[model samples]
Target: MNIKEKYELSSRYETAKKDYEKWGIDVDKALDILKDIKISIHCWQGDDVTGFEANNQELSGGIAATGNYPGKARNAEELRKDLDKALSLIPGKHKVNLHAIYAETDGKFVDRDELKPEHFANWVKWAKENGLGLDFNPTIFSHEKAADNLTLSSPNKEIRDFWIRHAIASRKIGEYFGKELGQTCLTNLWIPDGYKDIPADRLGPRKRLKDSLEEIFSVEIDKKYNLDAVESKVFGIGAESYTVGSSEFYINFVNKNNLVPLLDTGHYHPTEVVSDKLSAMTLFNDKVALHVSRPVRWDSDHVVIFDDELKEIAKEIVRNDSLDKIIIGLDYFDASINRIAAWTIGSRNMIKALLSALLIPNDYLRKLQDDGNFTERLALMEEFKTYPLGDIWNYYCAKNNVPVGEEWIKEVKKYEEEVLNNRK
Candidate 1:
């Protein structure tokens, strides 16, 4: 930015700081804490959920990336390049979440169960250079074994065992990332084992899923190296009637097993919201993980926006003082737009939400709640909506050396012209 723009940003930031200080909020402290908080950016978005698995089959198991956006990443290097571009546009150093399919096997056909740390050696090296940590998930869907829309919960022992092994390997890979990067990697399992129609035997699949998880968790890794989390879904496209890994099942399982529970914002009933679940989860579990997503009428994994629920979710993390107790990650794959722009928008919105949350006078608001001052509470809550959040946000972006306001658009356009438009 030019000197005039820099002077204006500084002046506005000062005025914004005064606005927040009226509520006894520390703008500098909030930005400091925000810098330390890392959101795991999912790698699948760059490639539209396509991975490097050789001779990959159609993306099955009830999930689909709807758009055929031009210049999608075709290989691991290109995906990494896309991710690098996205990260540069976004402020703060963050982690990258990967699926087993993202393993770089160099054109060799390596099954999920056989994946090892060596396959991700290049990723680890790149992450080290970029100062990013890595998170992983086992690819339990979009495979021949999962053609019937069942995996860990399959009645067939062979198919179930295959997924169980894959899950086991995924945890190990996550551990490797943690050990190598000095940050605990979360290995989350979101099994896509469910039925399209009403099941004759719901308990049968639950029993099998429980058994598979038990076996996978039996070979434990150090928590300092890796932590485990289980994500449950209400339903995917084909699994509308019954989701074997339902919310109740995974909650009970994770609670019993002492593993972290991951709440996907998109994986709940139409009336349900994950923002409402965070307080209880953080209160009960040592750490609760979150897949921050935007569901358009379903688990569509649309790009996240600065919506009410997004702000509420951030409030739960900040107001509850559970920022350190919650693991946050962005999980959405939208092929309808420029993928880098999608990543930048969603990630910046997340950070913006957190910053907005930090600027709230949460302690006083809670006191108002406890004192039963409903009218004033409601009044102040609505009043704060017009607070100078954008000023501080622009300052934060500028401070982090990122493009402030619409300036990032120029960078994205430049990359599209120089790199993406040529990816034929």
Candidate 2:
């Protein structure tokens, strides 16, 4: 921003600081806490979930990114370049998440089962240079083995065994990331193992899945280097009849095995909100993983907005004092627009919601609830909604040296004109 704009922003921040002070809110403290929070940005979003594997395969396993947006990253270099640009625009620390298919095999075909930490050497090197962390997932779909959409739970021992090896390899890679980067890397497992039509026996698939997980987690690495999490989907493109890894299934498994439960906002039914489950999960588990996204209808994986659900999710995390217990990550791939802009928008919104939650007088609200003063509690909650959130947010962007408000939009447009437009 120019001198005049920066001066105006400083003035607004002074006023906002005073307003929040009335509620005993220290804006500077909130910003300090926010600076320490890192959101794991997914690599798939930049390339529409397309990886640089030698084999050309269509998207499968109920995953799809709509729209043929131009300038999608065609290689790992381009994806990292795009992420570098996006991260420069976004404030605070962050991490990058990768799938098995993103392994850099140098034009050679490397199956998931044979994947090794060597394949992701460049990723680790790039992350270390940028002072970022890395996460991993086994690409359990979009392959010939998953042609039937049954992996890990397939009755075919060959298919299941192959994926089991893949999972084992993935965990080792996660451990490598954490060990090399001096940060814990979350390795999440999400399989699209379900039936499109009503299956005669539902228990069979679930049992197989459990047995497979037992074997996968058997080769345990130190929790300090790598953490394991499991994710379940309510339904997907082809698996409408039933999902073997339902919420109850994974919840029970996580509790039983002392593993972190990864909850995806797009992995539930329409009426079900992940915000409601935060308290319950954090209450029982020491840590939980979150894949925050916007779901339109059923798991469309739409771009996240500053919607009510996002705000509530933020409030739950802050109110329960679970920020340290929760691992937050973005999981949407909206190919309909500029991919880098999508990352900036979603990450900024999540940060904004968290900041808004921090500004609330939660102690007073809880006291009112305890004293049965529901009327006043509701009044104060509603009143805080109209507080100078924008001013505070703009000031945060300015302090972080990122473009304030819509100013970043112009930079994105300029990059598109000069860089993105050049790609065929």
Best by lDDT: 2
Quote the positional error of residue 282 for candidate 1 in Å: 1.3
lDDT of 2 by residue, 17-39 (tens): 99999988999999999999989
Could you tell me the lDDT of residue 62 within candidate 2? 96
Least lDDT summed over 10 consecutive residues: which range in candidate 2?
Answer: 49-58
Collision pairs in model 2: none
**Whole-model lDDT per candidate:** 0.93, 0.93
List residue ranges in candidate 2 displaced over 4 A.
none
Candidate 2 lDDT? 0.93
Summarize candidate 1's per-residue lDDT along 223-328 as a digit string, tens digits: 9999999999999888989999999998899999999999999999879999999988877899999999999999999999999999999999999989899999
Q: After superposition, how far is residue 163 of candidate 2 from its true place, in Å?
A: 0.3
Q: Could you tell me the lDDT of residue 319 within candidate 2?
A: 88
Colliding pairs, model 1: none
> What is the TM-score of candidate 2?
0.99
